[model samples]
Target: MITKDIQVNCSIVERFNSLDSSGRLAHAYLFVGPAYIGKTETALSIAKMFCCEEKPTAGQLFCGQCSSCKKADSSCHPDINFINSDFGEQIKIEQIRELLAQVRLRPFMAKKKIFIIKNVENITLEGSNALLKTLEEPVGDSLLILTTSVPEKNLDTIRSRCQIVRFLSETKQDLAEHIRTHYKEDEITSQYFAYFAEGCFGKARLLQEKKWFEKKNEIIDGFLFKGWNDDSIKKVLEDKEQVKEVLDVLLSCIRDCMLIKHGIGQNSLINVDRKEDLKGFADRFSFDELVAINGEIIKTCKLLSENLNLKIPISVIKEML
Candidate 1:
């Protein structure tokens, strides 16, 4: 069932199902949440509900036995279109123009044509401007579903045209329980993932699948002990996605060091497992050095978001360290 595919956002799911059941669905819906928080999965589930030939009678997921449901579940539905840009790339104006042409066509099988665009924030300025008309006035049998991790980055004109649905992050307890039940993990392992993920199920799953937790710890240790060099910086910043992850982990480790320096409780630290190492690093850096490093990290993150180079910002952080 589609609901089984969603590990969180139960309330939002129930409300959407009710709306669909009553035939009062919105023409457009903006699903907003943090990265790896099931926004895409929930959006796909809603799409299934809309496409299902035998819709759920109660406030539940679509009937899996129906032909339409099976097709949608398998991602082979002709009427449903999934649009997303390549990693670290914007959705170009050409893509939006293509989408405009596709939306004019009638649904081949289902009653409505569904378009699911993921990471709408990555839409270029020209692309967003081109998309505004359809968002404002859609065909009766067409539905648009947009999902984004950064809502603030989207145009206000576009956001004002659609209904917004916020997906709240789960509590540590709830997240841990979900991981324990769904992933078939023991309590301790589940708790670790839940804490490190900070309430995002997809992130927790990724961390487990990629073993990033240990890898990130190793990176932090290398940065603190061996210190940053040209070769190390080059290797870490090689990939765009890896650069983001590395920067995030580096920032967290520095934050943990700051907490230790301030005599803050260990519970507030993001890298709880590396508390002792963080403390040792904290002693080496003066308060001023830590502050400078933190400021550089903030700047680096902003630069990265704007598709700028990371070498300089990263090098500055290294100099401060």
Candidate 2:
């Protein structure tokens, strides 16, 4: 029997299985969706179909007990390759050249050679174009799986060569339940972090981490009650990623405050953290004034990322209130 616990997208799974049944699977596939939506997992599942020794008896897929499946699980499959980079650095032309050179060779143990590339967007322009050529004329039994959080960041030429399978963002309830179950958090916190996560497990994991909770609460309190003071926001600003997240949290909270001013319920608020904090602001600022502050957040977040004077925006945002 074919069984999967991880909410297998039935339609997508069907299409993939049908392709294999007809012996007409595409050479390249683009799995596009928000980060942490299991795009990588789905690609790995499909790769198993190409390499698994024990074929699925019920459906079109690899049996979990196969040696190839074990190899994939161990991340040491000779015929399967996975690569990603932090920035747009790893997918350069040099890497593409070497990978393309290898793709031409026959598979060692499996009938198919599979290359799974993560962060397709980070593949530089020259590298993407180079990849486009191989994608254009794929080897007879080779499959390439490209996964990206931002497929739009990749070159159109590379995108045009692949069949795109889109993953839907999980619901807050579903995602939160999953996190709470696996992460072992209190119910209220699980719900809180779920809403705060905005439907991304990667973000949820970061938000739910105990190490960050105290710091995050302190930051939220800093914005909610404290004067828009230099000493307050400056603490988080010390860390680039923390600065970005705190700013983003502020922007989102202010948005909630605006909605509340316009008669949106607290129940409807998106940021699960510090709703009372947003309420505190909504009580102090008018809807229009809150909106103006929200606009400042947009501008400030941009400037901060561009390495602009952070203190200036912080002062400006405070002064706007």
By TM-score, the best candidate is: 2
lDDT score of residue 178 within candidate 1: 87
Model 2, TM vs. native: 0.85
**Worst lDDT 10-window in candidate 1:** 1-10
Off by over 4 Å in 2: 1-14, 57-60, 180-187, 210-214, 226-232, 271-277, 319-321
lDDT of 1 by residue, 1-321 (tens): 346665546667668768876988888889998888988777777677767887576646677678888898788988888886544578989988988888999988877888988999889999999999999997767889898888988999989998999888899999989889888877656766887788999988988898876787677867767776689779978777777877788888888888888899976777777778788889998987888888888889899889898888888777777
lDDT over C-alpha atoms for residue 307 of model 1 = 81
Tens-place lDDT digits, model 2, residues 82-157: 8766544567788788888879989988888889888888877788878887899978678898988887688888
Best candidate per lDDT, number?
Answer: 1
lDDT against the true structure, per candidate, is: 0.81, 0.76
The C-alpha stretches of model 1 lying farther than 4 A from their native spots are 55-59, 86-88, 92-106, 124-130, 184-198, 226-230, 237-243, 285-289, 299-316, 319-321
lDDT (0-100) at residue 283 of candidate 1?
A: 93
- Models 1 onward score TM values of 0.79, 0.85
